[model samples]
Target chain A: MDRQAWTTLFHRLLFTSAVWIVLSGTDAKALAVGAFAVPAATWLSLRLLPGRDRLVLWRFLRHFPSFVGGSLQGGVDVARRAISPGMPLLPGWVEVPVRLPDGGRVALGAELSLMPGTLAAGVRGDRLLVHLLDTDAGFENAIPREEAAIAAMILGTGKEVGP
Target chain B: MNDLATYAFTSIGLFFFVAGSVGFLRFPDVFSRLHALTKADNLGLGFIALGIAFQAESWRLVALLFLIWGLMLLAAGTMSQLIARDALRERDGR
Candidate 1:
């Protein structure tokens, strides 16, 4: 499905499920209700919540795989931190240059922090200060992957590097 | 025991959300606000999730709650990073 339909479907599902929880409908009924409710809500929201752009939603889904991949990588890092025998973790702040606008920078910073071993220490202009626990593990050094992931997520392509 | 445990979790979660909001209101800058939000808000949400998880009637609800919790966690962490970075950026410009 195209991005718009997918997003509309998601919106429907989220609301229907939310409603089902509060009301406590039976299993089959809840599923049917939600199935109907979500699409209805989507239609209503589309009609009512005017001027809402779906670009970010589209971009987000496009970048979703990488985000999940990054999150999994982060989980592994946490495992490493938990299990690593005795080596002292070298924590350092590294700068990540963002070529996108402030909004994109904001989006990237938020997305990256979901990964393990990294906390957004600071941001200056379009540059984000990322604190990494295991700088020597090659993850922090290979900043391009994170950047590329963010790029895919926010801008949706390499060509539209910045705006 | 279960009732008491449930209440305790729920209360703690409510307390956390309140404390985080208070901090957000009182804090001077974006950085401090992010600091307030990340730990407390998430922990609060965690507590809320735990409370809900306990009350969940079926595996489906439990699984759905967990998924929602996971998404919330992602949002909290990411948004905080964005806030922290922007605060630093503004700080640097001045």
Candidate 2:
């Protein structure tokens, strides 16, 4: 097998083994069943979601901290608004044209949805229909920033104009 | 010390949960409520998981807690999209 295939296989095995340990715990009797089940499940998963795009682990790792921080901010921001008497929400929809390709577009949509005050409602052509908790939130500026990061994470550079 | 930590985290989790509930009640519309629900649930459950992680006997439990949280995040994102889309479609219709 090629190096990429081997890497994928190794990661898959490690993930399945960890799952097996979690499910079976320290029980010795279940080890036998897990030995058969884990590989079968891994194979099935691989078949269903074949790793088409080579996920750049280093880039992903680099991007993860920001994503986590964004999500936490999202939670706290909503909670604050929820408890506030003003409940200042100027909710509206904005269609932003994205520069990323299909995969990057989907990732950006999901990632933005997890962030504060943004929900990727739909996508038509190159524009993503986003719902905002506050319309004046400067989502146009903020989204492109995130799109840059996501584009880097997926396409290895923000300059790549995705088809 | 651990007990104190647990209480702090748990309370914070519960606080977010309550906030989410309040948002659900007070938000003007469906899209806003979803915004509250998804974000609040992610942080609420995350804090709760951290609380439990402090008391966990093994790393496996911590990993499992996080795994469950990740699954919830995925569900929240997908559900929010679905609900928001439906709401938008209805709005456009009128």
Best by DockQ: 2
lDDT of each residue in A20-117, candidate 2, tens digit only:
88766858778888889889988987886566555567888888898889988898899899999988889988898888767677677777887988
DockQ of 1: 0.15
DockQ (Cα-based) per candidate? 0.15, 0.75
Consecutive 10-residue window with the lowest summed lDDT within model 2 chain B: B85-94
Judge candidate 1 at residue B35 and give its lDDT.
Answer: 45
Candidate 1 residues lying further than 4 Å off, grouped into runs, are A1-59, B1-63, B79-94
User: How far does residue A83 in candidate 2 sit from its true spot (Å)?
Assistant: 1.3
Task: Give lDDT per model, in order.
Answer: 0.61, 0.83
Point out the worst 10-residue segment of candidate 1 chain A by lDDT: A75-84
Residue-level lDDT tens digits of model 1 in A1-163: 6786776667756755665555555678777777777677667766764323333457666766766566545544443333345533555567777675555565556655655556676565666677665577665554556666566655456555532
Considering just the first chain, candidate 1 attains a TM-score of 0.58
